[model samples]
Target: MEETVANFSGSNGPDNISGTPGADFIIGLDGNDTLFGLGGHDRIVGSGGLDFLVGGDGLDTIFGEDGDDTIQGSAGADRLSGGTGADRIFGGDDGDLVFGDEGNDTIGGDDGNDTLNAGDGDDRVLGGDGDDEMFGGGNADLLRGGLGNDLAFGETGNDTVFGDAGNDRLKGNEGDDSVNGGTGNDSIFGDEGHDTLRGDDGNDKIWGGDNNDVLYGEGGQDILWGNDGTDSLSGGDGNDQAYGGGGSDSLYGDAGDDSLYGDAGNDQLFAGDGNDLAFGGAGDDFFQGHDGNDTLKGQDGNDTMFGGTGLDLLLGGAGNDTLAGNEDADLLRGEAGDDDLNGGSGDDYLNGGTGEDQVTGGAGNDSIYGEEDADRLVGGDGDDFVRGGAGDDVVLGNEGNDTLRGDDGNDALIGGADDDMLSGGNGNDELQGGDGDDTLLGGDGNDTLSGGEGNNELTGGEGADQFNFDGGITTIVDLDLDLDVLDTSSVLGLDTALSILGSTTVVGADLDILGGDGSLLTLKDVTILDFADFLGIDIDLLNSDLGIISG
Candidate 1:
């Protein structure tokens, strides 16, 4: 067990040799051996045996070959390799190049910048300090880039990789792998197979390259992309950006302001807290803005989106999409295709931008607009204002004291069971007052106003307008005496000219036309003598249709 001063060589049997203080070269050949180059720049080789080799000082090179070996580069910049068998290799100080060549091995780059490779077999490797580069081979491996800025790759097999500290780049290349960027800004890639990747701290960028992968950005602002297959990604904190590149993927922005893009396939994105922006780029996708004011766009295909807990903007970009604003005041736009939009709660704005869309203001006082084509706009609850901007649209005031307008084309404005106002702005439109006392305004062109079951006021602004009544007291104002007509064909009495003339009476300053079923139509600011020529009682048609009135 005594130390040797000269460069020594071991025999084929088990031997122990320790070298000189100056630069020493020690070789262990065959059998199990222990070789130590104790000082200065040294070269130590354990050839063809299960051995323990150590390069103690200065810049050294140590190699453990042909058997299970333990190789240590104890000081200075060194080169170490455990070759051929299950080995444990360590680079103790300064910069080093360490390799675990074969079998299940454990390699550690203890200090300084190093390059470590776990070549073949299942291995465990760590880059202890300084900036380091580590590589894992074809079997299950555990690779850690510890401290400083580092780079690591888990190549093939199911591997676990960690970028422990400082800024690092980590990749899980093949098979099902797990990768974590423990601290500092990092970049992680789940390259192949179904993998799990996490950005534990600082701002990080992560990519799920192929197959179905799971990714998380645990802290700081992060960028995550689910590149292929069906993947799941979560941005745990800070403002983040997430992309679902292909296949059906799920992305979550757990906190802070976030933006999520569903690029292709049917993806689901949740912007959890913060004011976020989300886009369903292609294919049918789903989006949820869990909190804060968010903007969600269904860019293509049929997408469904929900804006939760804040003022949100939801757009149905293309295909037959569906959008809903779940809470607070929101804006919903059906941009293209036939879309359905709902403003779930609070005061909201809903616009059916194009194609035949269906828009609903779910609660609170809301403003709904049917922008183009034939759309159906509904004011779900509270006092709402609705406008059918173009095409033959249907505007319904569902509840409360609502206002509905038909801006263009032959639209239908229905006041559903509330004290409402219906306006026909242009073209030949139909306005129906469903229940409570309502007001109808025919702005231009020929229009039909029907006061369904309540006392109503009708104003025919221009063109030949028709007023239809169903019970209750109805008043007609701004009626062009010679152009507007009242169809009283549904009356029980007033079938003959004598009976129709007897029912016409002057009630206060208004001219009242009475029906047999206790219904009355009042012509405001007109005398019975002046309106008699506009009535059809004195004329008889060729078909003996007594209700025909020529205006």
Candidate 2:
């Protein structure tokens, strides 16, 4: 039964006491008691058994001093503490200080600038308003910093922490924990064990300290650091910057123009949307720029990068890397080490920098450079421009009207199909125009130029070069009569140079080969006497068909 008390001192039995509107004092000194401080500044204490205490109005002080208790500071700026046993505490109105001392407890600072200390045991605390500070003490706890600028620390144990709706600072100190920075600009840390940290809104800063961890920058322009261990970090929205420090980590820039750094170990970095930048530092890493114009750098190991969609720039620094510009006009540089690069679709620029590398310009008009070492460059479709710089390189213009340049070393340049231009710059190089009305330039050294099919134009720039002609109308320009020779071994079935001179017939200014299945070799600015003097043979011996003529 409920009893009205001016000063109630109960026995070792269950008691219910209510206080008057004036200044009152009530103490339920033993059994499970129920006390209410209805008005004025009152003091209520449940000194022994399991009790229910409520500070209903003005400035009040409520204590759950003994057994398991339920305490509520319902109105004014009150001070409440759940002492000893497991308790549920709520500071329901003004600025209050709530203590969940001993045993496992649940605390709620429902309004005002509250201070909640979940001392000892596994506790759960929610700091509901004003600028609040919460501490999750002992065991695994869940702390929510609700509203206002709050501070939350999951001290010890594996805890779960949330900085909800305020500019807050949250830390999961020690154990493997999960922390979220919700709403306003916040700072979060997962200190020690493997943790999961998320920056759910506003421009926040998150760190996953020690062990293997995962972090997500869910909104705003945030910064995330996955320090130590093999970690995974994602920048979920806005222009965020994420760093994967140490171990083999994975970093994702999920939206906006983000920057992701895979610092150390073999990592995977993805720039998902917006114009992003990603760095694969140390170890062999993988990077993908899924949409937007991104820039990806593979700084130390043998990394692989793909520019999926927009115009991206990929740099493979220091390792044998593989880079693919998956769509649009992108730029890829395989700087140092032996690398492989592909410019998929769009007009891209690819540089196979240093070591022996392989590069392909897939579709669109791309520009490919095989810089240093013996590299292979293929311009696949569209009108591409390919340069094989230094070493014994191979350059292939796979399709369209492409241009292939073999710069230095004994390089081979091939125009795969259509009308392409092949230049063998320096060294004893080989140039082949596979189809269409192609142009082949054998630049410097003892070079060989072959017009594979269609009506081709072949130019031998310097040194003693050889020009091979086949079934089509082959036009030879700047061909030295004394130093360069025409190779008609495939058309005339004659391997020796004397047999080629004996099988040529000059019809006007062109030398017609009779046994090439109607193949015509057009020698520009050269007559029958000029060809005969260069061959150092009788002019009639070169003019005679020897029963191998048509028409």
Give each model's whole-structure lDDT. Answer: 0.85, 0.85
Name model 1 segments beyond 4 Å from true: 1-6, 489-551
Q: Give the clashing residue pairs of candidate 1, or none.
A: none
TM-score of 1: 0.89
Cα RMSD (angstroms) for every candidate in the order listed: 5.1, 5.3
lDDT of 2 by residue, 1-551 (tens): 13333675677799998888755688898899998989877788899999999988877788898999999998888889999999999998888889999989999999898989999999999999888889998899999998899999999899999899989999999898999999999999998998999899899999899999999999899999998999999999899999999999989999899999999999999899899999988899999899999999999999999999988999999989999998699999999999999999999999999999999999999999998999989999899999999899999998899988998899998898899988899899998899888888888899988887787777788899887766566666665566777655465432211113222444543333442233333233443335443332234634653232332
Please give the range of 10 consecutive residues that has the lowest summed lDDT in model 2.
494-503
Model 1 per-residue lDDT tens digits across residues 164-187? 999999999999999999999999
